[model samples]
Target: PAVPAPPVPAPSDREGGRDDDTRDKLKQASAALDRRDFDLAERLANAVINSASPPKQRAAARLIHGQVQCIARNDQEAAQIDLRGLEGFRAMKQRLLNVCRKHGILGR
Candidate 1:
């Protein structure tokens, strides 16, 4: 009889789901922000930021979080978050910057 091949492993075994989980959280956060669900967006972005994700991923989360703050007119908080992830936001996503600028986080 021929030997059977090994079974394929499923994705997101929890132990190996750190990055994937955080990536999904970030996507959800962005979607929430797009939907103007600031509370949900902030919660999901905070989850990604507090996870053991790579620095780049965390930075992306910060960007979303900052946008939420800007939308809520929390300029100080948005500025602080922007400072934390300056390099990532330096890519100048016009819409994000515009939101910050409108809220005075990026200055007038």
Candidate 2:
């Protein structure tokens, strides 16, 4: 009998998968923001936003990016992201609302 070739790993199993990679990137971005590294946070969040990530991931990235912009006093840019997409994520939406309120991006 001929030898059979080994089965290839699924996309999600390859090198910890794209979702994992993107998730990790988002976590790093959040950490950078926590560390007060605005530039790195923005870059990392933008990467996630521009990637082929799922809608939830993209929404989270946008929230993080908007928060960074708000912190940097770029209220216009921060307010440009319509957070309605995050309505399903109640906690995240609340956090965004709080951030916007604190930054004056949203009316008190």
Candidate 3:
């Protein structure tokens, strides 16, 4: 008998598609933020922010976006993004608010 080749994965299965990429980017963005690599975090988050990703991914990106802005002392922009994206993320909302409050921003 001849040896059989393994079947290739379809587009939907390849790297789990764009949603996965969005998710990966969001994870990388968050990690980069935690690592204090604000520039890379900003770039990753910006990619997800500008992409047509799901709301959750965008929300996560927005969280990162706000955090980076805060680190950069862009209080106004941070407040805007954090407050808007905090809708479905209760814990994150509070955390962001606390961080902003600590920095004397306090989103409107």
The C-alpha lDDT values of all candidates are 0.77, 0.80, 0.79
TM-score for candidate 1: 0.73
Residue lDDT tens for model 2, 1-108:
999999997656764688899999999999999999989988998898898888889888888887886777567545556366566777777787788778777655
- Per-residue lDDT for 1-108 in model 3, tens only? 998999986666754678888988988998999899989998998899899887777877877888787766566765676668769887777777777766667645
Clashing residue pair totals per candidate (backbone < 3 A): 0, 0, 0
- Candidate 3 regions exceeding 4 Å error are 1-15
RMSD list, candidates in order:
6.0, 4.5, 7.0
List the candidate numbers ranked by lDDT, top first.
Answer: 2, 3, 1
Best by TM-score: 2
Off by over 4 Å in 1: 1-12, 92-96
Off by over 4 Å in 2: 1-9, 12-16, 82-87
lDDT tens digits, residues 1-108, model 1? 999999997765774677788888989998998899989989998888788888878878878888887777576765565556746456634556777878777675
**Candidate 2 structure lDDT:** 0.80
Please provide TM-scores, in order, for all candidate models, with all chains considered together.
Answer: 0.73, 0.76, 0.74
By TM-score, the candidates rank as: 2, 3, 1
